[model samples]
Target: MAQGTLEVVLINAKGLENTDFLNNMDPYVIVCYGSQKRKSSIASGQGSEPEWNETFTFDVNLGDLVSPLRFWTAIVVQRMTVLEKLCNIPLESVMEEGKVPAAPYNVVKDQEFRGQIKVSLSFTHKTHRHGHGMAVQEESYGGWKQSSTY
Candidate 1:
């Protein structure tokens, strides 16, 4: 098994079907990987075209080298009553291509197509190195330049 970090950038969504009857819907996203879950900020009246521009991170364990990730969106109507599900965005494509295409995902409500949400996904592996009795050289960049050897 290998451990890594899954990075999700919630860019925006468009053509979302508004669930609110009286006003424009305030939509937010719910991302899940295994038992972990994260949420994006509400778009707040953006309704059909909501822009999040937020980033979320999740620690993942790959068994048989597979990732389990999914995304969903919901609109807050009278204290979180309205719920809508976006499509399950795959992570394997991101792992192979560095970044997944920001494509529109089908949104569903009551097992019916409602709208679409666009998003991008990325994955990075954590590397471990053993440094024992080796000379350490460090360098600094930007603002001020510095170097040290030990």
Candidate 2:
């Protein structure tokens, strides 16, 4: 299987639906790529627009049909409700250009457009070697790890 790396930049979000009425929403992202998930730090009183400016990296396999890189992001509202919107991110762009510049993607709920979130992605092709003596190291995400056997 062809292996590589996928870099995700969690830029910021704007015009989000304020789920918190008493105070500004304490928004954070639960980034899930397959079984592994990473939780971002709360934006505090940032309210409708939260800027994380954080970067996350994940290993990807072009040959795996269901690689861990298959992540669907969901913005949690009140840390309970699913404020995630379905957005199509073309993996092909990463294959060709190797990077997707930071841009805004529409955020929706119940088929209604609610807001936008900006993100950027990049891919680095890594050579995979198969030999009798080989090793693969894995990282744990929030206690979740990708199962692999040598």
**lDDT per model vs. reference:** 0.72, 0.67
What TM-score fits each model?
A: 0.77, 0.71
Model 2 lDDT per residue over 1-103, tens place: 4567788888988888876787777777766665566676778788888899998887776543534333234444555655454354556666557788998
Clashing pairs in 2: none
Overlapping backbone residue pairs in candidate 1 total 0
Candidate 2, residue 89: how far the Cα is off, in Å:
2.9
- What is candidate 1's lDDT per residue for 90-115, written digit by digit as tens? 67666555567667777676788766
RMSD of 2: 8.6
TM-score of 2: 0.71
- What's each prediction's clash count? 0, 0
